[model samples]
Target: MTIPLPGLDLQQLGPEQSLRAFIGWWPDAQTRLYLAEQAVQAQVIYGGRMMHADHFHLTLAFLDGSSVSVLQALAENMADWPVPAITLDLTLRDVFEKPQVVWAGPDESQRQALTVLDQWHEDIWARLTALGWTQPPRRFRPHVSLLRHARIAADQSHRHALPTQAFVGDGVGLIVSVPGEQRSQYHLAATVNPGRAVS
Candidate 1:
């Protein structure tokens, strides 16, 4: 009797076990610098673990339950959707504990972005549902994730507020990452450039 060993490609198995997608803003250099400094200081002061500064992003939408190809197509369409560059001014309202996670609340502008994104999520959700996909259970929030897990004390909050920076989202991208890795790094599977119509 001959037995066959399963041949697997590790690269195909990423930090995540499921197919995940998110629409977010990638900050420019100046914004990245300011956030990095704040994260470092927060780490020392609050003892809260800091996310990789280079990976800092503002997630607008999250979706699961679609194939990579489907997500890629969605991203391609979004990149082609014509929309003006959105300018946001973020102000931290307060620090709040929501069950398992701690997050920084956003001001009016951030809330506005949340509203816009919520509508977009609905639109995408309908499309995916039509394609026979189930969505995740998490409710949408416009806040930025400051620290995760309670291992870090409340004292770890940054003494100085994070400075504000502006960025124009040039395109929408499809990103995928594996689970259990030290960092969840994503590659641009597709790029949807703004100010253009979908083909």
Candidate 2:
């Protein structure tokens, strides 16, 4: 998978029996660096588990715990996905205190990309529903999670200043959760690029 950026190639590295799955995109290197910087600051203020750099992504859909057969069917249905290459600005540093998740989401200036994301999300949900998958109604928010289980003194949700970065989302992948040495790891099960799907 290739982003619309020059000389930047977003590779699809292709996971599980009964897996906790989701659909998301790994942003470009610049975006990763900015997110990393924010993660460091968030940890200092919030005291949380910062997501690993490799696990940085903006999830489009979360497919709870799914059987292997359900994952296979979803992969087959994602081949000709309608995700076009688009750029988004990560400006909002949002925090949900109850869940203790700090994330970076697109600001209002990236409305065009958000619209495309909303439509693509609906499309994916519809296709999976047609396959007899129980998809609950969800209000989609485009954000890359930075910190989880955050324990901060003040209500700093969307109050901290983070470096603004532009992210190029050109593809989507099916990911599963796996046990890891330090934390749970996100493994890619299958991926569809801007024009094609690969396993």
Report the number of the highest-lDDT candidate.
Answer: 2
Q: Measured by TM-score, how close is model 2 to the native structure?
A: 0.82
* Candidate 1 runs further than 4 Å off: 1-18, 72-77, 82-84, 93-105, 109-117, 135-137, 150-162, 167-170, 179-181, 194-199
Task: Write down the worst ten-residue block by lDDT for model 1.
Answer: 1-10
Global Cα RMSD, each model: 9.1, 5.7
Best by TM-score: 2
Pairs with steric clashes in candidate 1: 14-178, 14-179, 15-178, 15-179, 16-178, 16-179, 46-156, 79-192, 79-193
Candidate 2 off by > 4 Å: 2-16, 152-157, 194-199
lDDT of 2: 0.71
Q: What is the TM-score of each candidate against the true structure?
A: 0.63, 0.82
